[model samples]
Target: MSARRQRWEIRPPAPADVRERLGLPPLLATLLYQRGLLDPAAASAFLAADYATGLHDPFHMRGMAEAAARIAAAIDRGELMAVYGDFDVDGVTAVALLTQAIGAMGGRIRPYIPHRAREGYGLNNVAIGQLAADGVRLLITVDCGISNYAEVVEANRLGIDVIVTDHHHPPAELPPALAVVNPKQPDCAYPFKGLVGVGIAFKLIQALARYGKRPANLRGRDMLDLVALGTVADMGPLLDENRVLVRAGLIALNETARPGVRALMAAAGLAPGLIDSGAIAFALAPRLNAAGRLADARRAYELLLAGDRETADGLAAELNATNRERQALTRQLQARAEELVAQSGRAEQPLIVLASPEFNAGVIGLVAARIAETYHRPVVVIEQGGETSRGSARSIPGFSIIDIFDQCADLFVRYGGHAAAAGFTIATAQIPALEQRLLTLSRQYLRDDQLAPRLMIDAVLPLTELSWELYAGIQQLEPFGQGNPQPILMAPNVTAIDPQPTSDGAHLRMRVRAGNSVFEAIGFHFGRLAEALQRYPTIDLAYQLAVDEWNGQRRMRLLVRDFRRAGGARNGG
Candidate 1:
């Protein structure tokens, strides 16, 4: 094990109106105020996520009018239409949403999701030819087709009109599609710029509703489930319109989800009526993503759109198995990646770029995220194949992987994504050159302080303020992510009254006291820190206050995130 000592820093939140309005205890109020819900009305609205108030008019996006017009024309003339999507959860959800929406609009529609291992991502010429051969006159691409200039050109040549509805960053030259509906486009004026691929498709559906061309009886909230699934899975920020969509979508997901989602939740041992972002992130998303990661993405697409319970259950089981397989593969690949990083003798390099022919391309992004987290640096993992190498990248906050790739555009055959996550392809021979170029770019852009990992704390609190009433008051800041994160509070000199090792030493069950209040706390995935339990009877802990319910009992529990030896005047020692 490495002997690197973990550092601790505490920054207290500025006081606000949390105590007065919600009758909250002081510590909980400070944490809530720091998270930006300083006003009572705003706090109420944030928790409620008023579905009616949050949703935007679908026609607000730039190309909605044109895209909807074309689709409406296709419906009027009864032209064959195809919904093209990517293979991941976001892509699968987009395909499901659009195909369902279009079918409801009395339009003849078929769904097409590219094979992850074979055809790769985005709209390809081969798929275009196949669609054309099948008598498809109009093709609307979801989750992809923004940067497929050559493929779009080929699609037009094959007499297929393409409408690109994507969220990926656009290149210098746009694809020659009928209309591009990406909010990331330089000149576009979409109010909410943080839409994922499914969000874009949702906008198109909204536009159809405005034109009175939508399915007359289709419920809008029914589609929110898909929007929530894709948005969270793609790691889109849970703020602005995304926050609105996901908040409502989670409610819909829990109450009236599709057969596939219902079956998936059952397999994952999650209650459908009580789903949250955590459930989607940890359970549903991975299962849907597994099909694309290890096998054909079509399996996921089929599962989501299955008509019968038996079919949906079977597919969900298969996807669950695939997810298990994917998890094992990722572990193996991560070990190999760590070995490569060790051998390179350049661990401190600003950007990590590693390539191996044996690495699975599907899980490279996840591998990149793991490597980035471990090293506190940006990472790009590449899988070198016969003629070309595919790569996936994840970045730290201050670093932009897409911008870095844009600087070395000459080396890539294709590249696209947001600032944080990106994907690309290049000739196998250009890997070294591309790596060197990205490192040089990183050295120029990254500051020394930016490279160090820092945890942002919402506030510092005394132990006396942790109460059931205060915990309930904090619920006003619900559905947190991106701009709004779950608040972390630090309390010093908290004595662990009862500390017991749990579950093969992976966790700790403890009761801690601060002033007059005593709370049950669990330190998850902190078995390695067991030695510190005996060394420090009273310590400082950073944690989230939550209500843990078990067998009809409800009590406040501290979900311990980080801990350190207490210091300064407050330390009883």
Candidate 2:
């Protein structure tokens, strides 16, 4: 089936005042202005998320001091503490970071991560009773427990003080825990609210460090590698405090990662000394997440904090094998989901609800994301079981999946997540009715244009802006994510001077000329554009500025993201 193509109207930014503010070249200034940073100070601050400048005082959070004090008291009294976490990469890393910190501080700590298939997500009464029975005096939750009001109450009844360090959105009724240190909490006073679950745990470590409570021997930077892995894997916004943590953490990962991370990197065929965000996102995160997806998350946590190199290597190999299995399962599930969409005769529906009794609950999120991307609509993938059917939902811009579930709260037995992604459970009988109701809700809320995907351009620049200086200047806006994104520049009326298809026939390598400048560009997975290239040499290209190193030489290249015919009525001036 041929997918519908949507044309986007691109407009170049006004370049008059931005040139004078940063004393930058016109192209760099125009790119900066297009990115919503007009002032030099703001541009500099945005680009430089140094550890010294970007980190905020952890105590600024509403309950950080109380949580820290309670943890400290627990250590001093020799009380047993349990770290409760979920069964995902973020949750596992949060548990691992806290476990390492607490152990280093000479505290008795145990980690509890529920099995995805058996125990499900968040705090449960059974787990609470188990912790109490194990003589856990204090329970500090990571990544979860923000909305477990009943579980927290049960823990309190069992004389277990609960401290929640989570990043999930808080519910209307807050859990009455000993101290809730979540940036997403409605009453939180923290400056930056984009911290991930592990990021929040790192903040607790930061708070402990302030009082000389952290281990004297352990360095703060050592744990940053974990922070980067979890922060990026969780898809937390790389802005504010998260930007700082990820920036420093990437450096730590590249230079001096822990033995476990090093071993995993080797197993994944990645060079240990040059890891970047892409490597972590595509290579490392999935392997660590695979354990939780297919098995127990505790295995991942153990791999990260393993003491012996041999064990770490063995665990890394196992994780690699599991990741391969996860990939195959996801592909099968995605294919089935697409088939269901076709059969429904509502493929263009604003929301996709797919259910399969054979679907694995752990990989449903991946399947949902794939469906959402393929159909350009929000998707919810449900895995039917005996008593309840669990589902995971992924959403597009302007549609909050969590809020949509909240609006239909009566239908769900339990649900929680942020705006873009969420998970829930319902009685198996309710699946059809719930799906129909959601489709109706999607029709009511989503407009035709909203359902179409968009490629948002920051600015249109001339070929003169595709210089080394301009590329380096744009790097000032580093560590970009939700609030800040990598700038996309448009170069118009450019003629393809040299075009050739790659050996694999999946990408096209080309050189384009505009005015007196010539630039090299590569369009990955766009070899089909070669047919159109023979008819028209001129094209408008939207791309990100990239620095490419080939054959021991460094040069600037435009990583082409999208393209269209130029110099016609469809092209905007």
Candidate 3:
């Protein structure tokens, strides 16, 4: 099947004043302007994000002082504490980081990452009861517990003072924990609200080191690798403090001392010191997340805390194996999901929903994301459990999945997430009603022109503009994800030369030419259009610049984002 199409939006020219003041190439100046970094000083600061000066005071975050003090006192009193977290990469990294920080602070801490299959998400009352019985006097949550009101109350009743730290949007009725340190709390004054699960945990560690007994071994920067992993994996917007943290965290990740990190990198066929946010998101994070989706998340946490190379290597192998299994299962399930879409004749609907008893609860979110991308529509993949079911949703721009969930809140037993992604549990009998409500809401919010996804083009340039200097200028914006995306340059009416499918027939390797400038281009997922060389005499291409190193020789290459026949741009701004 042909992939979903996108509406291109090419940015207008940068202001002469701003461009002149910045003293950069036109392309560079425009890229900065597009990202809301117009001021030369601010643009300079962003490009050169530093650790010491870039970080905000954790105390500025509401409830941080109390949360830090309480945690410090627990350490001083040698209390048995449990760090409860979710099951995904962000949650596992947070738990591992906190566990290490507490241990280094002379505190007895136990890491608790809930099983994804058995316990859906968040801090469950059953887990709290078990921790209380395990002599846990203090409970600290990371990446979870903001919405876990009953669980926190149960912990409080059991004599376990609970401190909740999460990035998820808070409910109207907040948890009655002793202290809640979350940036998304309505009244919290934390400058950066984009901190992911592990980023918040890193901030807690910073507060502890500053206010409490500063341990010699527990430096906050040392644990930034975990922050980078979780932040990128969780798709946290890479802007402001998040950019700064990930910039420094990438350094820590490149020089990571953890045996498990090294082993994981090796398992992913990556070099030790070459990791960046892109690598974390695509290469490393999935392996860690696979453990949680398939088996226990604690394995991922344990891998991070591994002390020996042997153990780390073994765990990395197991995670890689699990990831392979996850890939095979996802491919199988995605085929079924596509069939469902065709059978329903709602492939063009505002929202696409696929439900089945055979759907694996662990991989529904992955399937939903893929389907949403392929159909250019909001997707909800449900795993029917006879009477009740779990559904994971992924949405395109201008549509909020969580907002739809809130509108249909009465139908869901529980639901929580941000705009782009969400999850819920609903009685299987109510699936029809939920679908109808979602479709209605989606139609009301989305227009016919807005059905397709938009591709934001950073700049329009000829192939002659591609140079080593321009590539270097682009590389300054390191650690790209979410808000801070890699730049996409477009070449109008370029000729496609020698386009051919790759070995797997999923992508295309080609050459593109504009005037006398010709460069190699690789179009991922463009294999279906294998007649690329002959189909179009000329094409307009949107792409990012990449370096292709072959036989130890480096040359500029084009990582094609999309292409179309000349002058075929769909509503470009």
Extract clashing residue pairs from model 3.
none
Top candidate on lDDT is 3
Q: Write the per-residue lDDT of candidate 2 for residues 1-573, one digit (tens) a residue.
A: 011144455546646767787777665666667767789897677667779877899999989999999999999899999999988889998999999898899999999999998899999999999999999999999999987999999999999999998888788888999999988788778988889899999999989877668875678898899999999888888777888899999888887646788899999888765676667887999999999999878889989998888999999999999999999999898888888889986586778888889789989999999888777899999998777999999999888888778778788888899988999889998998899889888888888988867667677787875666666677766665555667877787888866778887879899888889888889876787776776778887778877656566888878787777775333332
Question: All candidates' TM-scores?
Answer: 0.92, 0.91, 0.97
lDDT per model vs. reference: 0.83, 0.84, 0.88
* Candidate 1 lDDT by residue in tens digits, 353-449: 9999979998999999999988889999999988899999999987888888889999998888889999988999899999899989999999887
Clash statistics: count for each candidate: 0, 1, 0
lDDT of 3 by residue, 114-141 (tens): 8888888888888888888989999999
Local lDDT at 545 for model 3? 80
Instruction: Highest TM-score: give the candidate number.
Output: 3
Candidates, ranked, lDDT = 3, 2, 1
* Residue pair clashes in candidate 1: none
Q: Which is the better candidate, 2 or 3, if ranked by lDDT?
A: 3
Name the lDDT of candidate 2: 0.84
Show where candidate 2 strays beyond 4 Å.
Answer: 1-4, 11-15, 462-465, 493-538, 547-551, 555-558, 568-573
Model 3 alpha-carbon miss at residue 204, Å: 0.5
lDDT of 3: 0.88
